[model samples]
Target: MQIVGQTTQLEAWVASRTRKFHINEILIIEDRDHRHPKAEVIETRTFNRYIPLASEQSNLVDTSVLEGLRSVGFDIEDEEIHLGKLRLIEELPTPIRVGAPARVPSFAEVEDLLIKRKPHEGLTLGVIQGSREIAKDMPESLQNVALLFDKENGVGEQGGVPFVFDYRSMDQYPHIGIFGGSGSGKSFGLRVLLEELMLKQVPAVVFDPHFELTFDQEFPNLPEDFRHSFKKRFVTLDAGEDIGIEFSELIADDIVSLLRASSGSITDAMETAIKALHKKSDSFLTYSTRMANLAEALDNEKEIREQSRDEYLNPNDRERVKLLNDLLVKYKDKVGGFSGTLRSVLRRLTRLEMEGVFTSAGTKKVEEAFAKRQLVVIRGSMYFLNVFAFYVVRKLYRKRRDYRDSIQKGRPVEEKFPPFVIITDEAHNFAPKGDVPAPAKGVLKEIAQEGRKYGVFLVFATQRPALLDDTITAQLSTKLVFRTVRSVDIAVIKEETDITAEEAARLPYLSSGTAFLSSAITGRTTAVRIRVSKTTSPHFKNPFEELEEGFAEQDEKVWEAVLPSLPIDASNLNAYLTEIGRKVGRLLSFDELEKTLEDFVDQGRLLKVSTPFGARYNKA
Candidate 1:
């Protein structure tokens, strides 16, 4: 079936490569030479499918050619799949003299030729079952289609041949972590990958800190239906709201871990205390035992308020005291002696009513708010802190465990606990590797170790990887590395992620928005040019640009907006010196300290007017 007048390069290559056995095609990497244009042609014949030697269990027989596949290696008893070559056909016109032609020969159409090649019951030559047609009902607004690749599609070329690490390959390992500097386009890249999975109906949860990812409006210009579908699947958590769960559902270990308490009898007491804290049937004594640790904090507010009342008796202080009194009265019974020393302390501390740390009304409102929303946003609130992150994570874990237990017990669990994604920004603040407060460390460790299976995924973003928990960092199978100037952080990332030294060195120089994307999902070690997100507004702006613009403005814009935010009363000379010392403690070098002080002076916040003994100080 060789064509009559075609060049024999493809045929010759096939003959040379498949000399010993039947091969689909010989794939050659096309050259980019332009001087001799024809030299750029690299013709390779490809097979849709090839029968390689296989064992009882179907695994591909290893060969020199297959070794090029990175990460995944070949096994015996397997089938070999190859890419097919694309042909450029030149359709010839009717050659005969029209009026006097011996016969009007009907030239075969490409589609008909393909159909004719399907020889009954025998090996059919290269033939397609059907052509892919654009769906007539598809809306014009939808601009992109999901890319599908199967055995027949062949290898796609994206400058070079495109490769995919099949889902099957990543089955053995599944944890993932992403890291990048501010405004590095990590969010955009993550969205693309997530969308791909959603289309496949692979259940996934993502914790988004900035609230940029959860809102439908966040991804504008998308087809309405597509947006709706994505939104329906997401569950958001807000820190402002009180997320509720049955205390009894949580295991003692989980409760202890959530609070970052040390494992021992203390944890047991904490767990017991948490379970008894808000139970309807529990006695005041039981309540006290559960919340005893913070009991003293209850009086802290009343004491402060009473002092304020005696000193200033302002209307605000009066109202605060009234609120505190209401809270104390409501929970006074629960403030009695508890089991564990810490539990008892917490119980007493939490006894303050409206006049206490959390007013009764405030607690109720917070709880009610969290219970209603599927997707919650916890940022942009003054109350949201490192402690808050721990609380939310712990709550979610407890709820998940309770749901599982209910299912096991054949109890009616109406609301399905949807998978959640936890995106922690400035993760070091909550999951610091070294001596951080106990609660943050405990729950974060639990999430890292066990959350993946329970439908919890963590997106930990940090500039300082060296300061992050080693255990949590190690569990991430996917890594997105952006520019990191610190050698320590770069080294930590490289060592943790198994990135080569050459690649590690390049991290410090990565251009803004450029990152090294490594995932088990895409095994090939290749650099990807991230697609710019057209849907979402560019909320993540350059901080330096914002700062420069803010400071450069006149007419009190800078004074009103920036001046009040500074810790020092630049007008007060004594306060300026103390602030400088405090700020300088964080600097890596004395030169930076000096430069910062000079900048402050130049800004007129620190006046450089006079000196004692000719030693000048930056006077506010």
Candidate 2:
């Protein structure tokens, strides 16, 4: 390869006759005075001299007309030359020498430039693009550190250096955002990231609104020795079952937030009713009771007044009337409103209760997971998680922040809470861009801005970057952008990250499992193919594929029960069906057994014979 064109300090063009230049491949330009400045190929092109650049011209001919030249031993591909445009990684004060030699650098020459840490020291994400050539020369520890996945093939051999991320650097540059469209490997990349975090034993809480974050199952197609089981390293918690909010800990704003998230929006009168009736020590039962009572009081005010005055009323009825009168007199000025407003607030509180948002006392299970340094996967619907996350994130963040603050000021600490990370999918729903009122958005925004100081960070992945909150998006110092076809999302990524125009233009065409990692930790953008995950979600199989596999499993079960009794006479098939039915957990009819035997015969597993008395069955 040679630098054939005029060269500048920042940009140059390299031409090769035999070798194809790859984008993002580092090249050392030969110049003794410049000390071989390193440049990365940003663009590449290949073309033949025989064909016109514009194939739509009137002089154009079909490719079949060119086939005769190949028979004469003239190949058009041999006339093709590869060209690459290079950008210096670090710009120099002066231009480079013209017509200088350019060559690939050895692993040692660019070790410091390419990787910041070894495989064991950082999160091994995947193989870096353009590193396949130099990976062979790398040390054994770095050589086969990761396995890549392909659709046509199973797991491909490790062909490049692993992209080990320095997660410790996240303290300096806090939150990580993953953006991509559907089928862009957005969720696949997230699973890989969480697996790495579990491998590192980073305490985390993953809000799984999709119910697809379980990691107990091992991944298929992995090498025997490389397989890992995270059965003990992670725990899955169902909302309202394993974890929930302690209603007593909530303030008026907490109640308002949860109510707003549950009902989409609350009226001003409903807000006033909540603030007036809810006390600092109120639980869900107490607060909801007060609202219901106020609405009931408004409905039966004249009856209650007359009942309290009537001497014929029983003592219990008189007591209930007296309390109702007192409540009406007490909140007459503060909660003076229609009964519908009070009923509206009561309905929202009841809805949250039915969904088990306040069924449990607290999130002690999540805290216990954190204390053990375990990854706690919290599963719930989008609405449930949104309502619960506001309470959970605020409580845990306050715990960590308070502990860290106490140590910094030399105050006595009452409790011990570890700093942890918060990860979630469908983050745009929680922290949406516009005025969409979601309860979780406020605390998530708080953690995005100030959580790093207390050793708390966020990993938010979403398909819609344009819909994610601007404040949170701006705080995301590291972003993994996968294939996105939407122009609006692409524009947001271009403005948010340091991706060059060339890379931005190629976003719609990137394959699955590939992403452009723009990180402040690396101080540059890297094209990366994500590594295979150690575990997959339980629902990873396509529903249609599951149907076929389910039938096969059922067939195997039935065949196993009948295999030992093979070669029996078809005359005794009824007796055999009764026994086979007991083993397969279902009753079988005579016609069903006859049809099954014929299927086995057609499949070459068995043979049917014509006997003098009747037909007979035998193994094939």
Candidate 3:
């Protein structure tokens, strides 16, 4: 150990020796008084004393003269110097005088200074950045906590160290933010974190719009011991597959939000109609029936007003009169008059019904997933995702909050809904910072502010954190930032985290699967290479590759089945498609068959000619 420069309680300049010091490397400083203080190297620089002071002052260094001096017996090489600037992490008991000795800490000293973990304190994430040597000597207690990739030493190497995060820290700071641009391993890191959560048996709901959270598939090269039986723990609510939610469960506000009602009159009118119709019948079909009845009543009222001066009434006048009277009496308060607003609201509601968003049977309840500790992945289009996510998040968060509130008030908790973590990849869409509100935003913001007490947490991942709600962003206690190129986003991250200018400069160039983790849990910023995912997304396959390897085998079978039915002479494309559909015993769309015909022409298997009547195709 050697010290060759000025020192202070907060900072020190240490002379570089044979052992090179790296940025973020921790070092211990000890003076003659025997007081040891810890500091982290933040900057490094090198200088040469061989350059004459007069030459530097004149800004005219003679390179030939310096080279001659160096060629001779001058000690120019010995004058070469390196220095490191270290910021204090731990203060000494007493103020250190100048010329304190600084040295690289031993494994035990490093463990005591930074790597030690309390009992059940934190989950191992990965090794600290720039601590490869010390990482090899991590304590045994943290070895099996979490398996992570070490960027410096590759996967599962000795340089790997336990990066632990205290779970208790979440009580005070609950939410987590994952920010990364495309190909930055944002989703991969999310999957790794999810795997850890699964091992802990924490019930979580993942809003997977792209249907990527199928954890059943085993990881490419993962060991048998690390593999999880995900099918038993995963509950997939796949849209247009097995997923269903009761339409009756949706409230008036939910319907209004779904339609994106902008006008106040339109929203009020829609809400009134929804509440009346929703109360009349719980089934979507029945609700439609009631709406049809209301429209019929409006038509009847118009008819009566126009024909009141008629000398004779219609044969079914009494039935019509009674029906209209009953409808008016029932909906007098709900629908004051059948205006265009009412019609628009009815049209939207009918469209929603046609979209088949709800069902009486096979409705997958959110409570079931929570009760069973299942990782529920709701997969669908953005519209369906937003709707389901809004309902599920709101219902679950409210239940947890109410349960906790009841317990606090000395009242018996009615529902025993377990706490859960809500995760969404496209979180900006769910809780956007724009003026137009998302239905999920209100409840998500509420959870962000108060979810910790209720044991609810949010793990929101987005490529564009700048577009995320400011309130939600502020509430995120931990932010894992992957490679981001946007200046605005980097600025936002800088404002939120304690990353230095040097670290911030590296944000755009960080490798895929590596991230800078800033969290209140660790009480510092760390660079971590995210671990590999045990299961990959089904849609992760390259479509172009699939095509190149021949994705037309199924189409060839259809062509073979239909070719025999085509006449030997030239045939109209539409007629050929119709005959093919009949022969195959399955109705094929004109557009689909037309594309197939075009492909056949491109392949020289069919010839198309513009005849006097129209275009015709024939086997080549």
Highest lDDT against the true fold, candidate:
2
Q: What is the C-alpha lDDT of each candidate?
A: 0.43, 0.85, 0.70
lDDT digits (tens) for residues 1-620 of candidate 3:
33443445666566543456776777777765745776777767554666455235333423433343344333444565455767777555544544556776766786654553542555445555666666556667655444554346433642545555665578887899999999898988888777667766788888888778888887655566555677777788775355555666766567667666222234566677766756623566666666766777775776655455455767587556566657766785677667454577777766655666565533345568768887888888877777666767877777778888888899977668788899999899899996756778888999999899899999999999999999999999999999999999999999999877877998999888778888887677777766556577786666897786564765776678657754323444556666677666677787777777778889988887777766666788
Total clashes, candidate 3? 3
The C-alpha RMSD of each candidate to the native structure, in angstroms, is: 18.7, 5.0, 8.9
What candidate 2 gets wrong by more than 4 Å, as runs, is: 6-9, 54-79, 307-315, 542-545, 560-580, 589-598, 606-620
What is the TM-score of each predicted model, taking all chains together? Answer: 0.44, 0.89, 0.75
lDDT of 1 by residue, 426-461 (tens): 676667787655455677788778776666666677
Clashes of each: 57, 0, 3
lDDT of 2 by residue, 1-620 (tens): 76654567888777666899988888999988889998888888765766564123223422332342343333445566566878888888998776678999998888887889887788899988988887769988887678998878988788987899999999999999999999999999999999888888999999999899988888888998679888888898888878888899999988889888888888787788888887887988877877788788889988988887899988888888888888898885677747888887887788778877786558888888898899999999897888888888889899999999999999999888887999989999989998989888888999998999999999999999999999999999999999999999999999999998989999999999899999999988999999988888888888999998997787778788888888778888888988899999999889888888888889898889998878988888
The runs of at least 3 residues in candidate 1 whose Cα sits more than 4 Å from the true structure, single-residue gaps closed, are 1-172, 187-238, 241-375, 380-385, 402-415, 537-620
RMSD of 1: 18.7
lDDT, candidate 3, equals 0.70
Worst 10 residues of 2 by lDDT: 54-63
lDDT of 3 at 456: 94
> Using TM-score as the measure, what is the rank order of every candidate, best first?
2, 3, 1
lDDT of 1 at 392: 54
> In candidate 3, residue 222 scores what lDDT?
57
